[model samples]
Target: MRRATTVKFKYRPHPKQLQAHRAQVDELLYGGAAGGGKSMFARAEAILLCLRVPGVRVLILRKTFKQMESSVLPKLLEEIPEELAKFHASRYEFTFKNGSVIQLGYLDKDGDLENYQGPEYQLVIFEEASQFPENHYSYLESRLRASGEVAERMEALGLFPRRILTANPTGIGLMWLKRRFVDPYPPEKVWRPKPSEEDPEPGTRVYIPARATDNPSLNKDYLKTLNRLPEDLRRALRDGDWSVLDGVRFSSWRENKHVLKPELFPISLLSGRKVIAVDYGHEAPFAAVWLCKLGNGLIIQYREAYAKGLTPVQQAELIRDLSKDEEEASGEPIEVVADPAMWSRQDAGAHKTKDGSPPVGSQAHAYQTVLNRRPIKANNSRIPGWALLDEKLRIREDGEPRFLVYNTCRDTIRTLPTLPRSKTNPEDLDTSAEDHLADAIRYGVMHLEGKFSNLDGLDDYVDTMDPMETYRIAQAEF
Candidate 1:
C-alpha cells in the first residue's frame, strides 16, 4: 500500500456539528431526514480523520453496491476538488498525500461482511445503517481492529478505533438500535428490563437529530422535488417520521366507510346451501360461523358463530344445534369444514364433555365415528381454501367491494383486517390475530367451490340429487 499524504480543505461546522466532530466519542450516529448534511458530514469526517493520522485507512460502507455507486461514489467525487481527486477510482478508494486511504464498500448481505474480516481500518463508516440487519452490524463489530503501529498509538492514549453511522429511523433493527443508543436509561426504574440489566454495554452509540433546516445549502431544485411529494411521504422525508406505505395491502380499508350498524344478518342467504367453517382455538374463543353467497354476487352473509370456547363434545353439540336451525329455516343444503390439522389423532384433553368424549379424537376410529354422526368435515388443505375465498372476493367491474360482511359476525369482521406481517417473513402476515374466522371462511369457500373433490360427474350429480342419494347411486354404479 502507498503512503497517503496529508491534505486539508477548509470547512465551517455549526456549533452542534463542530461538537460532533471534535468529541472523543467512540461511536457517533448523525441521523434523520433528507437535506441534513449527515452524509456530507460523514464524508468530511472521514477526510479529516485521514488528515489527522498519517497512513490511516478508513472504510466507508453503504447498504448495497448500487448505493455505493449511486450516492456515496458520486457525492465523494463531487465534494473533493480536482486537486485532491487523484484518488484511485478503479479500486473504489481515495489516497490522501499523508498516506491515509479511504475505501468505499457495501454490505449488501451477510456474506459481504466476510470480505472485510482480515482488512484493518482505523475508522469505519456505516451510511444508512438502519437498512442493515442487526446481525450484520454485530458481525462487523468483531472485525473492528487497530493493529500494529495504530494499536500501539491507540493503546498509549487509552482510545480504541471508532465508527460513525448515519441513517433515517426505519427498519427491522429499529427497536434494537433505539433501545441501545437513542435511550439507554429506562424512563421508569420500576419497569425491570432484560438483556443488559445494568448499564448498556461499554460501547459508543450516539443519535443526533438532523433536518432540512440543518443543511441550508440544499439545492433549490431538490427542495422543489421534496415539496412536490404527497403529504404523508413529504412529511416522512422532510420530518423523518415513520408511516405506512399504501396501495399494497389493506390500503383501501377505511374504518368509517366499512363499519356499519351491528345486527343479525338476514336468514335467506344462510338458509339456502350454507357452509360452516371453523378454526378451533382453546385459549382464545373458538370461532365457527355460517356463510353463503348471495346469487353470483360477492356479498358474504355470515349467519352466526357458535358463541364461546367449549369442550369438544360441547362444540359438537353446538354444531348440531346450528345445523338444525339451518335445516328448519332455510332448508338449504349445508356442509361444514374445519382446519385439517385439527383432525389429527390428538388428545381432546380437558376439552371432553361431561360424558368424557374428547373434543377431538386420538384415534382414526374416533374421526370415523365423528364422520358417521355429524354434519361436519375437516378441510385438508389451506392454500386451496384461501384461493376459494379470494376468488369470491373479486372486485367487480362496477367498482364496489368484492365482498360484503353482515353486521352479525362482529368478531370475524373486526379481526380480518388487523393482522400484522410475520416478523420472520415479509411475504405473509402473521395470521394469529383474527385468523380463526378467516381460516374458517377460507375453508367454507373452498368447500363451496367444489375444490375438495375432482370427481368427473360429482358436481353435476350433487347439483341435481341429494348427497345421500348420490352416494347410493355412485355405489350402485360402481
Candidate 2:
C-alpha cells in the first residue's frame, strides 16, 4: 500500500472539463448532455478542493438518497485514496487527516432543506442540480459561508463560499436554472446582471456547456442511448440545447423574438381591439392580462396584474383599473373574459342575495356587483386554447412573433416559457406548475379563435373597430 504525498491526487481534465475547473464565478453550472463528464467534474472538483484546503467544509448534494448512492458516492469513493480520508457510511461523509470534511446530503422533498439550515460550508455543490427546485438552490446559497481559520485558509486561494451546479437541462428546476444561468447571455462566458435585470444579484455566474463527445474516455454506447431519446429529450441531453425542454409545449418562445421592450412594442401605436383576460384565485396568484389585438395581426400583452389573497371584488376593481389605459388607448369598450369556474356557485359566507338571510351565489356575482360588467366565460377547451397560444407564438411575415409580451408583464413572461406539456395528454399543459398567467394568456388567445388562424385572412383581418388602417390606406391613394 502506498502512503499519500502532499499532492497525491492524479487526474487529467479534457478541454471542456478544464474550463469547468478554471471558472472563477461565484456560481458555476457545468451543464448540458449527460455524458459531458458533468458528474465526473463535480467529483474531481470536490476532491481537489478538499485536498487543497485543510479543515475546509464542502457539502455535495443530490435530489435523493438513491442518487447520492448511485451517481455520486461510488465515484467519489473511487477518487479519494483510503489513507488520506476516512469514509463514514452512516454519515455519508468523508473526514480527511488534515481536518477537512466533505458532507454528502440529499434534498428530496420540501422539508429536506431544513436539515441544512444550521450549517455553514465554504463550498456547496449540487449534483444533477436541475432536479432540485429553485428555492432549494436559492436557500442553500445562504449557507455558503466560512469563518475563523477555515475562512482564512479558503480566502488565500479566493475559493471561499462558491457553488458548483451540474445539470442536463431537464428537471423541476430547469426553467429557473436555464433562466438564471443559460438564458442571460452566450454560453462559456462569465455573466453579471446589469442593474435593470429581474435578478441583478451582482455576483458573477458562468454556464459551461458540455457534451458526450467532449469526453473521449466515455463509453461509445452512451451516445447510442442518448440518440434513441425523443427529439426534445435528445436535444436537451445529447445536443446540449437549452432552448428545448422535454414536453415543453411552446418551444417556439424566444425572449429575443417574443419578449419586447417599450421601444420595440410601441404601446402608444395600438388602436386595435383589446380584451382583459383573468384567471382568478384568492390564496394563489390572481392573474390578469390586458391583451391588445393590433391591426397588423400582432397580439401584445400591454398590462398585467397579479397578486395573492385578493377577494373577487378586489380582483374586479383591479380589472377596471388595469383596463382604463387600454380602453382610453383604443377608444372603445374592452371585452372581459374570466375563468369558467367563476360562475360556479359558492357557499354564502356573509351576505344575502336580496333579502337579509345568507344566500348561495357565484364569485362572478360578487365580482359583477363591484364593476357592473359581467365577464364572459372563456372557452376552457384545453387543447384548442393551447393550440391557439402555440400558433400565436409563430413568427409573422413582419419577422416578429405574432404573440409579444411587454417587458413589464413579468409574471406572464416568467411563467409562459415554463409551461410544459402534460405526460398523460401531450396536448394539454401540465397543471402542476405556476400556470395561472399562462391560463390567462390561453383564454386571451382562444378569444381570437376565428380570426388570423388560417393564413388566407391573417393579414386581411384588420381591427374592425379601428378605422386608422383604412384612413392610412385611403391617404396613400391620394
Candidate 3:
C-alpha cells in the first residue's frame, strides 16, 4: 500500500463535510446557501486522498473556466506546499511531486466530456453542478469507474464514493433537489443518511449539507455586505433559504438611493418620439404609462392605473386626451403601444366581417384610434419586449442606470414590484403585473430602435428594433 503524506497544512473543514469525510462512508454531498465552504471541502478531500495514494489521479470538474481560475485553482495552490504544486500551464492540470495528479476540467457542454471518455479517476469533484442541466452530470458520471487495485483500495477504505456535487440553488426545478437532499429521507444501513437515492443498481452515494457559517475564516467584509442587503435578499444570500415572493421580478436589481417619484412631461417641452405601454385587463385595472426618449435615454414620464369598469370607449377617450396633451406640449405625436391582441384583430367573441375586421371589434381599438388614424404597434412578444426594456434601463458609465421614473408616476412606482409571471407555471417575474406603465415604456423604446430622425445622428448607430428579434434572427442563420 502507498504511504500517506506526513505533511500537515493549516486548514479547517466544515463540521458537516468534515464528519462525513472522516467516516468510512463512500459517497458524500455538501450543499445549500452561499458563502459555505462546500467547494473547499471537496478540494481538501481530493488533496488528502491524492497524497495517500501517491499518483492517485483525481478529476475536478467546474461549470466554467472563470470559476476554476478564480476559485478552485487559487485555493488548491494556497493549500498544497509549493514543492508539490507543479503547474501544467499547457494542459491546465496540476501535478504534485508525490505523484498525485489533479486534473482540472470543465463541462459547459455535455459533449465536452468526450475527451475523457476512457479515463478513470479515484476522485471526481464537481463545483457548481447545479448550473449545468441534469443530463451533463449523468454523462460525466459514467467516466468515474476506476479499475485495477485502486478500486479494491477504495472498497477497503470503506469509502462509499463515486461522485460529488456543490451549488447554490436558483430558478425552478430546485424544489426537486431540496426534496431529494435538503429534506430528510428514511435511513438505510448501506446509505444511512439516504444520499444515494438515485443509485438504482446499488453502490454508495451520500449527501452532506453545508452553509457559509461552516467556513471558520470567512472575512468580516463579506458579513458586512450581507448585513446591508434588503430583508429578502439578505435571507437568500446569507441564510441560504430557498424561499421567495411569487410576484416580484428583477428581485436582484437594487439601488443605493432612496425611492424617487415620477415626473410629468409637459406637451410644450417634450421632444423626440413619444409612446405609451398598456396592460389591458378584463376584471382588473386598465393601466397605461406615457414614455418619452430624452437625448439618448428613456423615462417613464407619466402613469395612470384605472379599473376596467369603464367601457372601451371611455378608455379610448382617456388615452386620446393624454396623447393630444403630450403632442401639443412636445411637438411630437404620442404613439400609444398596446397589447397586440387589442389591435388589428377580431374581438374574442365577436363575429368577423367579410373584410376580416370583427363585427364588434375591440373597444380598445376604438379608444386608441381616436388619438391617431394610424395604429401604433403592439408588442405581444415576451422575449422581444423584455430585451427592449432591458436595453433602455441599462445604466451608462458614471454609475447612472439607463431607465428613469418620473415623480408623478405613482401607480407605476407602487405596483412595479408586484408584476405577475409571464407564464402560468414559471418562477420568473410575470412581466404582466401592475405592468401597464412598464409595458408602455418597453414598446416606446423598441419602436425607437428602428429609426430616430431628431437626433444629430448621435444615437443613430442604435438599432431601432427589439434585440430579441436580432438574437432569434442570428440563431436562425446557424
Please give each candidate's TM-score.
0.50, 0.71, 0.48
In the order shown, what is each candidate's alpha-carbon RMSD? 13.2, 9.5, 15.5
RMSD of 1: 13.2
Q: Write the per-residue lDDT of candidate 1 for residues 248-356, one digit (tens) a residue.
A: 1232333333333434445643433567777666666667777665565444545556455566556655666666765666544356566655544555354434643
Query: What range of 10 consecutive residues in model 1 has the weakest lDDT sum?
Result: 242-251
Candidate 3's C-alpha runs over 4 A off are: 1-6, 23-27, 171-176, 184-199, 202-205, 244-478
Q: What is the C-alpha lDDT of each candidate?
A: 0.60, 0.79, 0.58
Q: Please, what are the lDDT tens digits per residue for candidate 2 over residues 1-478?
A: 9875664667888999998999988899996888998888888888888888898888999999998989788887888888789899988899998888899999998899899988789889999898988888988878988899888888898875789999988877788887888766778989787766755566788999999999988999999999999887888899877767767878788777888787865768866777888898999998998888877667888789999999888888888876676667666667777887887765635443453211236777766676566667776655545656766787667777888888888777667777887776665678987899999888787675543223243223332423344334422321
* Comparing 1 and 3 on TM-score, the stronger one: 1
Per-residue lDDT tens digits for candidate 3, residues 97-216, read 777788988877757878678777777877876566667666766777655666676666664346666756543324334443443332222354423657545545455655667666
lDDT of 2 at 100: 85
Candidate closest to the true structure, highest lDDT: 2
Report model 2's TM-score to 2 decimal places. 0.71
